[model samples]
Structure formats: structure tokens, C-alpha cells
Target: MATLGFIGSGNIGTNIARLAVAAGIDVVLSNSRGPETLAATVAELGERARAATPEEAARAGDWVVVSIPLAAYEQLPVAALAGKVVLDTINYYPYRDGRVEALDTGKSTTSELVQEHLAGAKLVKAFNNISDFHIPSLARPAGAADRTALPIAGDDPRASADAADLISRLGFDTVDAGPLTESWRFEPDTDPYAMPYSAEPDAMRAFWAAAGEAIRSGTAPQTPPHVDQGVPLTAARLRTLLADTPRKLTADRLVA
Candidate 1:
């Protein structure tokens, strides 16, 4: 009877909640907009989920996931999350999050900034690389040969192991990508970003082409499609993709 809490009930947050509940974990979801706004989502998740204020969600979790915009990191409830293992599914997008000087000069990885703001929390960078649409579609039963392995990076080994276990229970394997500093490897525009788990390169490209256009034109759909279960990525393959690759930043990484 474990409970997972969320600080943002947007794309990534809801998807992870769905997976967690499906795995028998209860979820407490909150957003910047407030709990009442999440009524429909709570109903959709059934009895295993409920909506609360951000502070309540922060304090309620056995382990919490913070999937908010990176710009809002410092706004998180620091006291509530002080000693918790916080999973960060946040990435830096200049256009969406504005410019961050430390990131601009390569002095900080996104999670490091999050960790610094949360102080005593054990933070792990995770669930950030994959597209939210592909999340549920890609999840497979444990021990399934084709189960995809997501990458996680943390400064603490024990916390990383706990996070890895969380990912496994939600139906994915995990590959350790060293410390938080190395998290940049799987960010947007990198080899392992969201493309590999997309199942088919063409479908991923087509959906993004249409979706990105819609977003830019101010009409993006609420749910992304073409992901009827992506390719099952193995640990070996993911390891190869995680090799010593340099970061590649571009405006194309803007994912709103």
C-alpha cells in the first residue's frame, strides 16, 4: 500500500500517475492551478488517486515526483520535501522557461538546480527524456524482454536505487547514467531523448511534425498520438546510446 505524490499534474505528471496506479500504488496529485481543477483527472484515476494542494501532495508521498516547469523549481515547498526522495522530470527549454545563466554557461544541469533549491532532499533526474505520449504505450510487464529501460542520474546511490525500483514497478527498467552532472546526455536533441523509444522513427517524426506545428501556431492537441506502444528498448541498447556523447542544444528542443 505505497503512495506516490505529484507536484505537477500536467502531461508528465498525469502519465506517471496512471502508470503508478496501474502498478497498485496510490497517488496524490497537485498542480499550480489547484486541486479543484484536477477533479476530472482524479475521477479518471478512480479510487487510487486524489487531488490535493501542492504542499499537501509534497508531504503525503512516500516518494514524490516533481514534473513542473524548470522555471518554477524554486517555488516548490522546500520544507515539505526536505528529507524525501524527489524524482525530477524536468528539462530546460529556454523559450518556455526563459534563460538560465548557469545552464547557459554549462555550469549546472537542470536537476542540480532543482536539488539546490530543495536543499535536504535526495533528488534524482528521471522521466524527463521520454515523450509523455509514449510513456504508457511503451510500458511493459516486468521481465518482458523488450521492456524499455529509462535512464536515471543522482548523486546518491541509495536514492538512485530506490528511484530505479520505482521505475521498474511502473513497468520499465532503468539504466544509471552516472551522477546528475551526466544527465545532459539524454536531454532533448540527444541520441536517447525521445526518439529511440518512439518505436518507429517515421511515426515519431510525423507526430512531432504535426504536433510541433500545432503548438507553434497555438493549437496543439492535449494528447499526442501515433504511440500505440513504442519499441521495447533493452538495457544493452540504451547503454550504447548513453555512451560518451556531447550535448547538442538547439531551438528545435523547444517542446511546449
Candidate 2:
């Protein structure tokens, strides 16, 4: 019933747009390359989808998803996104994003930086941990046995709740992982980063904890494990994993 606008229509953006359309949400897609480059994606999403400039998409969306590289956060249209609910799906990779002193020094998290740029917008961090390739298969209708859960972090309670509802409509439950500062828990290489989980919350939690332990100990399984991609997990498991996970210094995390 709502229109979802995307500032970056790459792998994660396009896949999320597909899910939004499947949920009966219209989508306006945009990218730095120009609206023309999004023709195929808009067509694939059918009548409910259209292509537009980043600013246009920002103005058109009920909720705007900013999935662009972390380095490009400053380029987002600030005025157009004013007072909008923004879903931030950015991750920092020094090699890819070059060096961002704020991120490198742990002065602020990635979502915090985006929030600073779009000062009037309500920013929520989510969908960054999962791989685009696993999204479709991992989704399940509400109450389905195989439904999965995703984590979201934000400073605004209302905005966070709205984001959780949207995530549910997209076929996954939401776990409030505190404020944006805590988002690093689900960032790259963390326990809950890209690990798949079961429809059951408990199972999903367990999977997160196990995965976290494995990663810290250097025993995490390679992608495409013997089993299928979406692994089952529980909340209790995730808590345990988070407890066991050692907090790395910002300097150490930035090295790679």
C-alpha cells in the first residue's frame, strides 16, 4: 500500500524492491548511474515500479532505503529526505569505501553518519548483514514455520517500530538490537552478520551464538555449507554468541 524508494538499486536494493513489490508495495528505484540504468529492474518489478533520480525517489517514498556505499553517504539529497523514515543498509569496507576517519576511529557508527547527513530523516539500520542472494528463499509468509528474523537499530522508537512492521511485511520478523551504536554487533564479520536463521526465534538465536563463536574462534563454516544456505537458529543461541564475542577495537576492525 506504500511506495518504497531506493537510493541505490544494486544487489541489495533491487532484491528488496522485489520483495516490496511482492508485498504489494510500489517501488521507485534510483542510482548514481541514472534512472535509465534502472529500466530493467523497474520493468521486472512490473506496473507498481518506476525509475527516478535519487532526489525524486527520496521525495516519492513513504520510507526511503539508502543502500549506497558508506563512502557516498554525503552525496544523498538532504532536503528531499527531510522528515522521511530512512532505512540504512550500509556497511563499511575500508578497501571499498577508502578511509573514513570517523568510522576508522570509532567516533561514530555508519548509520550515525548517515543520520547526521540526513538530519531531518529518521534513520534505521537493517538489511546490511544478509546477502542479497539469500533474501528471496529466506523469506516466508507471516506465521510460516520457516519464517526468519532480521535485526534493526535506530534512535527513534516510533521509527524503529515502523521499520519492524515493514520487515514483517517483507516476510521476516524483527529483533530490536538497541540503538544504532549497537549495530556493529550485526555488521561485517560479527556473529549475526549474514548467518541464516529458522522461523522459530529460539532456533534463530542459537544459530547466531554458534556462528559468533565459530567466527571468533576461526571455525566459522564457509558459505554454502553441506546443508542449504538458510541455517536454523534461536534467540537464546544468539545471546550466548553475543556474550562470547570479544569486542574488537575500532583500529583493529579498520585494518582490513
Candidate 3:
């Protein structure tokens, strides 16, 4: 089994670890606080799980998952994560991450910023749109009629495909939402962000289709629109991390 390391084991990170362990994957979990502080989480995950420092967790896994807030991206050890397949499950929340002038000005995407930091890792964007309350509830059999679909975006074809396969094995379908640049389509303010994973896939697709149609027809409700493009996660000493990249393919090949 591949070792899964999580750099920040909070709600989404812990839940991903739980799901991975239930599926028989070994997990190395860590948080910003320290391994000693993650005792309860490691204990809850049993023998398949262990606690380690952030860098140790990054170094331990075949695939590393970065689930910390965007503000703490610099704290992630980029050198240790070199050559690993990284799953970025973070989304930008201006209120929580503080304001990134670029994001505020519709200039960049959060995933791009993280990618710039982990220059040696094959980064894929996923798990960002769904809320913590819905993650566990979304799991279903691979081909179950009501299975959920999770979108994954990234630059590397193999990495994205591998992520899709792992996601399917973990009980959901994968929708390739395009490159890291297109990840904004699935960001926090978009319909796909929080509306679909907890519901049926078909329903979710229908929702996006409708939203697109509405946007084209000028029937969409006036709400805060999703920032139109991807942004680098950070610009200076204080910033660096976050979500997905896209794989170019026929429109039909977009979803798994």
C-alpha cells in the first residue's frame, strides 16, 4: 500500500486520512502544532497511522497531501516534497486567508501559487470545493448509481490520472476540470465548489450546465461571481501553498 502523508491533519486532512486508512492505505499525519499534539488523531487511526512532524510527514508518503490554510504555505518544506505526487485540498477564503491583492483583483489562482513552491512535485488539485461536513457523506461504491464525482485539476497527465484512479478506488468518480489555470471554475465562489460532492453526480453536472447556460443567457442571479482566472497562491515571504492543475483532453475525456 502507498504511504499517505498529510501535512496538516485538521478536518479535511483527518477525514482524508480516515478514508484512506479504511481503504487500507498507511498514513503519516502531522499538523502545524507538532506530532505530540496529534496523538489523539493518530490513536484514533490505529496501527495503520502514525504522527510525525510536517517535514517528516512530507518525506514519508508516496503521495503527500497539503491541507493547511493558504497563509501557512511557506511553512511547508518544499525540498522534502520534491518528486512526490501532491494532492492540494485547500481553497482560498479571503476572510480566513486574509486578502491576497492578486486574488482580490482577479489576477491569480491559489493552486498556481502552491505549484510555484513545490517545484519538484507533481501537483494535482482536488478536495478543495467540498465542505468538511460533506466529505464522509459523499463516499459511495465506484459504480454505484448515485456515486459522487470529484473534480481534479493539474498539469501532469499521469499525476492527474493517478489521482482520478485513487479517487475512484476511494469511492467517487473524477471530473477533470482543466489545468491549474482553470481551477478557478471550481473555487470557493463557484457553484461547483460546495454544491455537488454531497449530492448525486448527475445532479451536480446538471447544476453546472444550468449555471453555464444561465451565465450565457444572462439569467444568472446577481451574486459574487467566482474570480475568473487562476492566481499564484502567494507573492512573497508570507505566501506559497494551495490546489489543482489541468490535463488537456477531449471534452469527453474530461470526466471519469
- RMSD (Å) per prediction: 2.2, 6.2, 11.8
Q: How does model 1 fare in lDDT?
A: 0.87
Output the number of the TM-score-best candidate: 1
Query: What are the per-residue Cα lDDT tens digits for candidate 2 across 1-256?
Result: 6999999999899989999999999999999999999888888899999999999999999999999988798999999999888999998866557777887787888888889888999999988977676677688788887566777899999999999899889878777888888777777657676653423434444554565455555685344223335654444555555445555544565222
Displacement of residue 145 (Cα, Å) in model 1 is 1.4
List runs of model 2 lying over 4 Å from the truth.
196-228, 232-244, 254-256
Write out the backbone clash pairs for model 1.
199-231
Model 3 bad stretches (over 4 Å): 198-256
TM-score-superior candidate, 1 or 2: 1
Q: Candidate 3 on 1-256: residue-level lDDT in tens?
A: 7899999998899888888988889999999788899899889999999999989999999888899989998778989999888999877654446667666555667788889888998889988877664666767766676566677789998999988887776766777776887777677645465543333445545555555455555585242233222111111211111232232222222221
Model 1 clashing-pair count: 1
Model 1 compared with the native: what TM-score? 0.91
